[model samples]
Target: MTEPTSNKPFTEQTVLITGASRGIGAAIARRFASVGMNVVIHYLQSHEAANETAREAMRYGARVLTVTADLRSVDQIERMQDKLAQHGLIPDILVNNAGISHYGLLSELSENEWDEIIGINLKGTYLMTRQFMSAMIERKYGRIINVSSVWGISGASCEVAYSTAKGGINAFTKALAKELAPSGVTVNAVAPGVVDTAMMNGFDASEKAALENDIPAGRFAQPDEIASLVYFLALPESGYITGQIISPNGGWLT
Candidate 1:
């Protein structure tokens, strides 16, 4: 369909989502694909899973590409960029959804564990955004949507490292949004609450139910629900909304 009169048509634009092999990332790829938009799914080690996502997106006749790269390495990211350039798939929208979760007591957490969490969640977002944002700035029209967590807003107890990394993402979104605003590139973060993804595997059935009861909605959110919010933020109509951490956590946090 139709997009804002001021911007390119949805069919002509491309979206690149990092860590898109499964869960929220995959949901986002499918969301864009539903509208027949160009979709690029980036994964670290999920070749098969990425291909599966590509197949699903192809059902809507979207141009889909799967690229594997370690976001922690700039060299790999540069290679990924080169490959996309060869395919004429420069992204109009960049979703820094690639991240990892950490659950442990701060006392028990090793320095390496802390580094890994920050590297993937915070540093990876920074690297990916830095790599792709120049093209968007050149066009003076783009969307940068970060998939964060509600814990980022209200820190979690056992998930100190995860919370810290996501909190960094929240801050990054705010600061970068201002820098990119004059260029007509909007930057925002979607901090979702508990979702029914593998990220919740650490919690047992009883723990999950207890957590769900704590949420006003009485259930974990589905990945698609978060994807819907992301899709909205990427729209031309949402140009006015930037530098905001919009959390869809079923009223789990204000």
Candidate 2:
């Protein structure tokens, strides 16, 4: 972790959060906006949801922008960059929170399924980070926070593809952190376990209860809890905390 002096006030910084239409991404957006930071909410196709998130952030008196870009496409991402530049909303903090999860055994996974998961989860992160990091490097100060999964750290039973993608993210974070540390930019990942989001809609009442019972905390983590950790990591004072895969798993994993 390297400490870089910044003359800009924290309120002037802008954070771009991908997949910010809802869930943990939305919570993270609100958390930053609450402190009057400029927020750019990126969503794939959820226009209304993204607008709703923008509206909520605006309540905090922060300048909010909603962008629609398919992270899987470089052309779209470049266009997104152009749009952000046009709006004077280039990000000082980049949150690669856009990702998809896959379930079931690897044997049942189709080629397309694997590609979609990897393309969005892994490749998208690479493209987004690559596109935005140069600016951060030139500025000599930035935060790159990636959203990962506990399954990436400790592999899950059935989610092989999803787990692999997130594991790649974990590795990416470590390597990029070291690469950017010299430039005074920090890169880290937040791998949460069993967050209470729509991603768990596939589980039934019994399944949910069974999973919860296995954890010492006896419940799933809320998006706001994860958002708070992200907010802390993005703080200017948190410059010494880079290359960490901080997992808030309710004591489920040590």
Candidate 3:
């Protein structure tokens, strides 16, 4: 295993995490903030939740800014970029953790539902990456970490749409990593299994217990655990570790 690089100081870096109002995204933001890096917490409509996350991050003595934008909109994202530029916060690290999970039978899924899932999970990632990658290429330094799911690697039965979207993310991560590696930008994905976040609220007590029993670890992962892996990936020493789909799934799929 390669050690993390420290050539770049934490205080000099900035991170932008989407869907960071709560759950895994919020944890990732806090992880970066804990190191005193500038943090940009992006949310679609969770203004108050985002603010709460911002407050927590700021307590770590890192500059925190909350911004909102519909990832599916080019104009909004551009405007968001403009706002970040105004604040002098061009992200050195981009965490594409903003996504939604859909759980339902494929046959019963509506067209609109499918579109929404793909649009937010896959398309949104593409757009955000396209928007910020140029600067990283120019500077020859950047980290792009996509928050994928274990289901993306091992398909889930009832979550066909969600699985498909995340599968696309895995492919996107690999291909983009190869393309950006030459430019000194590393692209990777963190696919966690059964994280204990609001996303799992749909399951009841019995369901949660059954799922845990299925995993060898016998428990769901914490958001901070996933965040730690993301943080490690963003390190300068991890430059050689690109084009990988790192699933921290507690022996669930492997």
Candidate 4:
């Protein structure tokens, strides 16, 4: 990564994103890159995809560092943090977007399934936030955006585990926002409605269409759409907004 020029806005500082190889994560990296903000793209098992994102960000004049680690383990996260530091990539903003979705009735869900969803969706967020948030507090200038789901706000049937994990994320966002406010570090969540991403591969075309029909917008959101909100929340002007779970559900749930 090239050194930061003598003159650059603090907001142009580095932003680290977990699970940023594709979908909303990729969109977010682009959003910051457009503004020349250095970005650290984190991915697990998507090294090739992450490198592609890195190159794309570099095209926009921002330094991009791509790293890999499973979010399920705190040790790996600590090591990942160290790798960023080695690259001179401490983040001024952190986007905790790494998570997996599990679908099944409560009666049919297995213990492993429960742990997988909870581990990545909730625990990973906590781990990443815990690992890097102290730096934010020390600087008194940072943005932490947690990418949650609409189901987190309104529970969904047949997706009990996923909903529970997201609900926990919402709670975390609210609680942490208050704790970090005094330090000038803002914490917020962007809960999105169904978007056209690979996560929806489980849904049949007909099921997707039916779900879209229920939305007031009559369509699903693009990954870029959700990324826009994440970018906006990280702005210097967004300091006053915290402890809030903002949902972008295409009016699906009022």
Candidate 5:
């Protein structure tokens, strides 16, 4: 595999991370920012939270901008792209980290619930990727990282809808990687297990402890840990690693 000609330094690269208002997305934004890369924090409604993350990122001396868009809407996404273009912040890296989770028996899941879950978790990734991929292909150098879940690989009993969406994301990552390979754009997914984010709030303390005990690492992964992995994947040296679904599950699924 031939590497793309290095056009810009890492410090000059720009990364756009969706759902970056908080949690893992925020961490990933900060991770990229620390290296002096421009960061675009995209949020659906968490404007205040997004600004908070932007402020934190700016402390690292990186340029930070926050954009709001409903990922489910193509028009909104286009508007966001226009805004970014106006600011000269077209992203060199795209991180599809915006997703929602659902927990319940498949039989108990309502149609609306299913659609909402699938729309945000799966369709949102598709829309964002479709919108931005052309630019990456034109530039011949880009990193597209999708934040996935361990449940996507090993089906979770209660999280059927969530698992299915992430599974689709995993598949999307792999297929797109192959399609974009010739263009020097690497596509990959980071599937994490039991992260200590608000997403885990549904589990009480005891439940959290039980889940932690099941992992050989004896603890849930910190957001920063996942962020660090994503940061590594975005590096120019990681150009050759594509079409891979890397699970950082702390020995939960080997």
Candidate 6:
């Protein structure tokens, strides 16, 4: 296989992606690996799935590493940092793609449900960025991509928890981009309308049909399509394009 290109050229830069066992995360990992970029795929569980993704990424002749971390805890994140250092990997790009979906009446939601969703979706983003971002700042170059949802921009019925988390991510992207831009780091969000990923496992065929019908493009998005836009945003040419929430929804929401 032809090797994918590495975005971080000077150092053995790594792209750390959470929730990378499958779906959009897997696609993102493969895209970077195709260009021979070192990728660190993180997962909370699903060690098998994560390994599968790593193997696929390695096919492109790129270095692929896997780590398991509980996004809710700071100590686990710290351990992950140590593992990266051991591998001679310093992250230059980070993709905050780990999130959970919750669909139900807000009134019926339990406190634990709220915490889990917010912890993994919102808090994890914060922890990961906080942990890995300093290296980028020191190097004066970095890319941070937050995977958001169309619901984040526009609230979705029965999905308050998911929407809220994504909304927070959107805001975080904007705020952090400004904070890091002066240091030559760029932060952006990719808000996808709908993609055929396991996250949609909650939706039935009929519900998906309706969502597809509502979209002007008349279809759901593929993970690779989202990955392509992410790849573009990570490029050096994309330095001036920070603090933007870009949605590739096939004209669904717009």
Q: What is the lDDT of residue 222 in candidate 4?
A: 95
Q: What TM-score does candidate 2 reach?
A: 0.98
Q: Each model's TM-score, in the order given? A: 0.97, 0.98, 0.97, 0.95, 0.99, 0.95
Backbone clash pairs for candidate 1 read: none
What C-alpha lDDT does candidate 1 achieve relative to the native structure?
A: 0.94
Task: Please report, as a residue range, the 10-residue window in candidate 2 with the lowest summed lDDT.
Answer: 1-10
When 2 and 4 are scored with TM-score, the better candidate is 2
- Please give the lDDT score at residue 11 for candidate 4: 48
Candidate 5 residues 130-215, lDDT tens each?
99989999999999999999999988998999999999999999999999999999999999999999998898999999999999
How many residue pairs clash per model? 0, 0, 1, 0, 0, 4
Off by over 4 Å in 1: 1-7
lDDT of 6 at 63: 94
By summed lDDT, which 10 consecutive residues of candidate 6 come out lowest? 1-10
> What are the runs in model 6 whose C-alpha is more than 4 Å off?
1-12
Across 11-107, the per-residue lDDT of candidate 4 in tens digits comes to 4689999999988899999988988889999999988989998999999889888888888888899899899999888888999998889877899
Cα error, residue 167 of model 4, in Å, equals: 0.4
**Deviation in Å, model 6, residue 71 alpha carbon:** 1.0
What TM-score, to 2 decimals, does candidate 5 have?
Answer: 0.99
Please give the CA lDDT of all the candidate structures: 0.94, 0.95, 0.93, 0.89, 0.95, 0.90
Model 4, stretches more than 4 Å misplaced?
1-11
Which residue pairs collide in model 5, if any?
A: none
In candidate 6, which residue pairs get closer than 3 Å at backbone N, Cα or C atoms, i.e. clash? 4-34, 4-35, 4-36, 5-35
